[model samples]
Target: MPQGPLFLARAVYRRRRLRDAARLLPVFGLLLLLLPAFGEQSGNLAHTAIYLFAVWALLILAACLLAPALSRSEAEGDPETDQGPQDMGDS
Candidate 1:
């Protein structure tokens, strides 16, 4: 019963915060795609496209920067059950 790297990855991804963040990524991408539609309403297609592209790029960069911090915080908050000080002399 040996688990592979994929199993380990899935386990880490199951963390609540990480899972929520993963779910939000697709929704964010969808919003980015839909942004052009809203810009069209403003009657300045080119400007709107440029603005949305910049916004989309910035958001992706932010997400990449924040993802590692999120994982580190989650790891820190979860206590390791296998390693801890044990009481002695009271068997």
Candidate 2:
């Protein structure tokens, strides 16, 4: 049976490198939120907010589209390991 894209994404997020990359989403979001502060139009709070919001939304959309691909690349470069929780019952 063929696995769906969601299944592949779930598998990718299970990897350490991929998971680490995934954790950056919030950092990026915060940075994007602060972007208007660095702009020359800081005086125009409304325009700055709208511009920042649009850019941030686009960035988030791009990240969502790219995350799976990034994770897949990391998975390919690194060796696969057991992704499930450790079994403590043994030994």
Assess each prediction's global lDDT (C-alpha) against the native: 0.67, 0.67
Residue 72 deviation, candidate 1, in Å?
Answer: 2.7
Q: Write the per-residue lDDT of candidate 1 for residues 1-91, one digit (tens) a residue.
A: 4343544443444555575776687688778777777654757767876877887887788689668867776676533333578566666
Model 2 vs truth, CA RMSD: 10.1
Q: Estimate the overall C-alpha local distance difference test score of candidate 1.
A: 0.67
Model 2 misplaced regions, further than 4 Å: 1-17, 37-42, 70-80, 83-91
lDDT of 2 by residue, 1-91 (tens): 4343554454455565456656777787778788767767537778876878797888778688768877677657533343556566875
Task: Report lDDT (Cα) of residue 46, candidate 1.
Answer: 76
Query: Candidate 1, which ten residues in sequence have the lowest lDDT sum?
Result: 2-11
